[model samples]
Target: MSTTRHYINLTNSLFPLPGYAADGYARIKGISALVTTFGVGELSAINAIAGAYSEYVPVVHIVGTPSTLSQADGMLLHHTLGNGDFNVFSNMFRHVSCVVSMLNDPHEAATLIDNAIRECYVKSRPVYLTLPIDMVQQKVEGERLRTPIDLSFPLNEQEKENYVVDVVLKYLHVAKNPVIVVDACAIRHRVLDEVHQLAETSGSPTFVTPMGKGAVNETLPNYGGVYAGDGSRASVRDRVESSDLVLSIGSIKSDFNTAGFTYRISQLSTIDFHSTYVRVKYSEYPSVRMNGVLRKIIARMGRLNIGAGFKPNNTLPAVEPESSAQTITHAWFWPRMSQWLRPKDIVITETGTANFGIWETLFPADVTAISQVLWGSIGYATGACQGAALAAKELGINRTILFTGDGSFQLTAQELSTMIRHELKPIVFVICNDGYTIERYIHGMDAAYNDIQIWKYKDLVAVFGGVEDKTARTFQVRSKTEVEALFSDKEFSAAPFLQLVELYMPKEDAPLALKLTAEANTRNNAKA
Candidate 1:
């Protein structure tokens, strides 16, 4: 039985809907559902769904099409492009989704639904289903409803897993300095427990890529900082690159994730543990998976000799040098965020400056950070915040926070009204730079195209129907002193209601990581 929450009648666009589903999946670590009309609506949402596909988020996308009889008769549909083809939209979605099912037969509807959902869960990607209006009420099997769909991943063959583990141990045991690098797939595959056990048992210095920011417990003594090639802090870069053995867990080496493919670690010294395979040096074991292999490796940790007397460096780069200018710079703001965040909070960052800036922010324990680093849609964080907030509310989490640049927030600002309608109490901090800061760093430093029309960002809550002093509140802070006071406030920290903070920062200043990445991006684009 599905319980209907109040309908969100004021959705501005379909672009943010997939962000909601993707972030909901992130929070719950399960599949999320999205419903759209047949043609026009699904096309508008395809970009974000493709983003979910790129980042490995499992979202079940259901489309409501015309009746089966209408599609069969080739009737002209209102949402169609004045054509008789009904499968045009589904055909487009095939490139982005794991499974695209059209429920035309009542006998196979249940099996199709079950298979679609199971594949979505197992693959950690979106699946599309077209349910005609006529088939909504069709009864297939009540017996199938009694048995829940099995959502387990296939276990690796024990013999192959053992061989892979032995090969891994051979490298791990001999290396004087072995470090673990956890990436986004570790979180998507639900293997953080195995990751944590391996890190703890081996006592190795563990680092995360930019996409893997919150995968490990940052408060742990063995935790190193974010490692993104030249974008990383000098200490972290040297530590990771100088290691004798690298155990990369669920790594996704995208251009942005690795600072434009700037990783210095060699494949010969790295053993990669993936969802479906294990690569030890140059040899690949196709059937061996990470979760089981990690478990077996942990069982034999007594034979490992690495990670002894390896002091971990988790400190932020010096902040006072850049923060002393009275205005809140990216350098100061991100590191200061480390002090403001609480344990178990859900933090969503936009793809612009906030995405790279967050690399410097050290999270408290069990914090979940959501960002589209690979897909990198500009306004994705605002919509994702809504879904993450809804999931957090359902899970009884106290706080959900969003960090977005002013330019990106404008693209999906209408989602704020949805947040108000749902009465979700999330703290939103809009970096009120005058333009697209990340783009400026990448290419157009002085171009007019980079500038934006600055709005009264703090007034958005009131414009979105949030009652002042009750369901919502707003603040504008410029100086470091003002930001410090705001962060120190007990009531504000508790997040009793929806709060918006218009944080003003220098337009040209960006995080160290973004600057390094943009330089690499510039160099790459200039290459022949």
Candidate 2:
């Protein structure tokens, strides 16, 4: 863990963050630490921690409690629940926490801290620890910290690997049209290399879920488009559904990830390779780790001649439309932006219109796309952009790009201050329509409730601590010609420092897929 410091400090500590923080953790492949004050801070952060627990993301929440003397005297603290008991907050965290600890005694503090960290990594869940002011500097044995934490899931029976591999290879040999479906957990499990090798070795078409977008090199020869059942493109839906066999790696089948359970693949011909288990057809091999199996599969790729599977058709064009009629519609803008993306750029898309529109983009090679698909939380992208930019900054990679709607940006726009504070530079493209366009498509198309006040987006950075030309700059483009010209400009495209672009289009402009999905969700919600 880097001990430098966190990017931003929320005044309320009630920010919408579980998804945002988890978004960074997924990309960095490390534990995220969220610090807070005693009762008020802990309780405010509890829900986000619980969300992390639900999604199997590792998070360590450290809370600063009252001093030992105050707790010993049972003095009521300002942030407390207004009672004598401090144990109430700790006990509440226990229900959602994988491990809970309070550092009151020095003798046991080291063990408790080590065990908490170990459990969090092992289970990939959240842990809670309360540190009293008095115990902050207590001395403990340094030798204990030298021992490495064990993360290996070793199988007791030596035959388990051989048995599972033989069965999987046997099915692969006979499968005519095998397809690889890479999900979000593949990123969390850190098997993207294996995913690439497996897809290439099998000579099969590869598709990524929304949560797993950019996990694979989308420019691969056999790369297919995003496959979300009815939400998918026409060609993508047909090709994926027609596959004789589906190989799901680190799969997560949440409602939003699966387009509200619209996937039509049969379990009888599906093979599921999870973190700790593998399922072939209806039979499952318990404790069979994917980490080992992926290595063995990659090693034997040359001998298997797995190219006998179905050949994929490259349906997505490099550039679909060369000319637009001066109007910026979803179909026109997405394909055009696809041409604008560059390699090594880290892109973050907001929920609603940006998320749906991004699905239509063909990312350049080595680009990483970040989104909160399952969580479906608005205002998440701005915070996630800050974290991802910081990660990219740490990696010495510039060109952090963001695509967001105006409504979503307003919810968490304060995080822009954090980005400026760190001297981090990211290009933010704000889609400026007049209202909550996504919500209007879902429920009320023209309801008064959906409207929001218009702000001078180009002037926002001045209020948010940006010094134009020196540290920040903003642009307003209302037409396709103007937008294209801005992108083509050497100065704007360089993205030398922080930049924001306010893109204006019609209020009703949205991808057709989001509209359909929203309609389905509205119906589903109405039923209940």
Candidate 3:
């Protein structure tokens, strides 16, 4: 057996090497199932690492911490050095990770690490393993070193097969108006083939949750548009709510994505295949293990005499094409966008008017919409665009396009530095309204705080150290003709280009998002 040594020389030594290497490792591998003591101060790096591995990538994160002695002694920390240190980092990751464990004994480290990896890979979620600094130097007796365990395929095979067959049969036999809601899990599980097969064989209309926007090639004929609050196509929403069976494969009912639990589908009739549990809400379906279940369902579906639904009636309202704007309307901006897009374009939308408006008005099967729905973080669009663009580049796909409100762009515009540094050219379409249109409309807050300091967006790209000729470029468009000309231009399609198309959207344009925001504010104000 080949053996290797990890010598931990100093207290701070571990931090710089393993800790630094861990981030790089995760970025390269695109996942983290291990946890480290690195906290919020390390967030930008951690998020950058996590973002690098995001969307179905399994990462094993292991965080190292000060020993129990340091914690008990209450040592002031450099990285938010703290008393009760373990809990501090644990809490920080709780929201973002699938599972977390703090390792107290060096002997159990191997087992814990194995378990974390197994869970992360199986669930396709970020898992964390925290090692106390004291454990780092502990020696394992050569004889006592355990055999490396492979926790891969933890699910019982026969049982998993049976479960998959059963679900498939259920879908084939029972539900009319069946729809499949794809989420990030579908991609992580590498189940795109299965999803396409199910969609094709079942001939069921498929709608992607916001996170699952590109789960299936949006170009498919059966592709129903995205289903989110006001963004949902009315027919798709009706079909989802009214369906006899809603197959929510890898979909999470997180608050942000669901518009605060607005959809009316009873959890009972829903068949949820998650990373951990297989839940059938209607029959009080006993939650079972996930793996073989899906396989079995596919097998059973092959034999079932289920009738295919009629060719999907594309009876949905035509998204009113943005008539070439004699003047700017949210409606006009999207159609111009739709006209510009080719198949396989990646479009990232920030949260607010841009998300609510542009996403609803235009339907580009090729566009990949990226947003932090669970967090609803405003500035996330820009950072997420960076990640999406990097993902596109790594996959050798189309250059990404980003739509950020003038307000939202300012929050993480610094990420433009990272974009330029990486030589990722994304067309940043900035809707230059003067204020936070969503907030102003929602709260009826004519508040001055909602108004932001404006910057000439096209000029800022150069200020952010973007290369003039090869790396980035910018544009400001006031009228529809200008927008259309940019869309039709073949030369702008090339990489390492940043086109900042500036549009003077009226504060009144995003009525729906504004209205929802106002109602939410009223309720919040009432609660206060």
Candidate 4:
């Protein structure tokens, strides 16, 4: 019994896979993979799958592209012209994947495909193999077309282990207040257990980057919340700046997420366990197998004479008063929302005005889940909310809420159909100010371009297949009283409901962080 499924995408006009029926082939059990092309919307479909099943299933991608003849001519190509030509398609996904390659020769096809699949299984990340369109039907010599790909972790030599151990141990000894920063890589790599063990052993506070929001459950004593940009907690900022040693596990310093490299933590004596090699400051440590290095470090840390020193000091900076209408509304809204939150209810916020304000407000200790994408795509929240809601359902938890801006929500409004289809209920609060409020704030633009066409919030649910006036509900609240009333009603909190609360947020009501961002944008625009 074969456990792997294969999906072939040759056009019917073109030659189909020989002796293989396309129907029911997509239904195989254990290790399934898909092969398609860049121009055929396969990348987007694959990405959706990757986002949907990031931790559990691994996907091996084989994409077909135009021949080298077309590449040399630089002809206008479909889906291959974005972001600095065809090469950037791979570069854009580099952070999300472990490996990607383009294969031109028909002779190398079998070996390349075999290796790509093996790497995908081993790394537990989506790996890619781009083949030219001309090569799909070409005659190949030597091996069979259906050769089995091995999925196994190769053993590392003793010398490689010793070298990695020495470097890690030396860094541990030199710094007094060493903190471990974990990112999405830790979760993707299934190293959460190891990370927890390492943090407890070192007695250091574990700070997670935004993409690594739930790296360690917020309930843990040593788990410090997100540390990046102006939204970072004051204590976290103080700790990062003052720490003598910073050890980053699969953490990259990207611009937008890091607030343009505002963190002044010196890289001296820093150790980075990146995907390619182990790096310590300016020096590159030789390539060592990651699993071996992680295991050895965890083992050595367990033997160290370290005591738990992480203490939760929740004191935040005193709120400075701002007289904008937006500030006033957010100030009132956040405190009330904070008070209403039960520790069990999961809150997923979109990355716009809501992200800025949510970070500023106080919530019940460890009650919220914010999906901070490093890519900073606007529509990320809608899909992420659906994913989080599904996750909550699997855990048998009810009452998931999504707070999103009107502009951001517009990007993935189609996802509401998915929400209705899956029967996953979430209370969605749309801050409908009738425009891209964040962009206006950032650009200091009081122009008409930022404004968008307004729609009746309640009518959208009916259009998207929700049960009329029963399963789905929408509310438009302009004042604090209406906001309180909507939540206080039992009918509103019931199963599989969608409530679109319209709050009349002013164009001038900007948060402090957003005000700073606006000023920065204005300065940049002036320079341009």
**What's the lDDT of the predicted structure labeled candidate 1?**
0.85
TM-score per candidate: 0.96, 0.90, 0.76, 0.69
Off by over 4 Å in 4: 1-118, 121-156, 229-231, 289-291, 302-348, 357-372, 384-401, 479-504, 510-528
TM-score of model 1 (CA atoms): 0.96
What is the per-residue lDDT of model 3 for residues 196-312, given as tens digits with 9 covering 90 to 100?
Answer: 777777666777776676667655676776665443556667767777777888876664455544567777667877655667764423445444566556545653233243233
Task: Provide the RMSD of all predictions against the true structure, rounded to 1 decimal.
Answer: 2.6, 3.2, 6.2, 8.0
Model number with the top TM-score:
1
TM-score-based ranking: 1, 2, 3, 4
Candidate 1 C-alpha RMSD relative to the actual structure: 2.6
Local accuracy of candidate 4 as per-residue lDDT tens digits, 308-421: 445543343335223333232665565456555665666766767776566444345435454544444565666656655555665576767777788877767766776777
Cα displacement (Å) at residue 139, model 2: 1.4
> What clash count goes with each model?
0, 0, 28, 1
Error of 3 at 480 (Å): 1.6
Clashes of 3: 28
lDDT of each: 0.85, 0.77, 0.61, 0.61
Candidate 1 has which clashing residue pairs, if any?
A: none
C-alpha lDDT of residue 407 in model 2 = 86
Which residues of candidate 3, in runs, are more than 4 Å off?
A: 1-40, 43-87, 90-118, 129-153, 156-164, 167-171, 188-190, 229-231, 267-269, 285-291, 302-324, 361-367, 511-528
Q: Give Cα distance to truth, residue 265, candidate 1, Å.
A: 0.7
Candidate 2, residues 1-528, lDDT tens digits: the string is 333323323333656453365445445545667777887767766766666665666777788889888988889778876777888999998987899999899899988987887677766777888889899998988886566655544543558887787788888777777788898778766678889888777668889887788888878877887888788887778777887778888888876677766788999989998887989999999888786787776676454323332333333344434554677777667766877889998989887788887777888788888777776667777877877777777777878898888988888788788778888889998999987898898889889988888878768789978999999989988888897798799888888888999988799988867876787777778885
Of the two candidates 2 and 4, the one with more favorable lDDT, higher being better, is: 2
Off-target runs (Cα >4 Å) in candidate 1 are: 1-13, 18-22, 25-29, 307-324
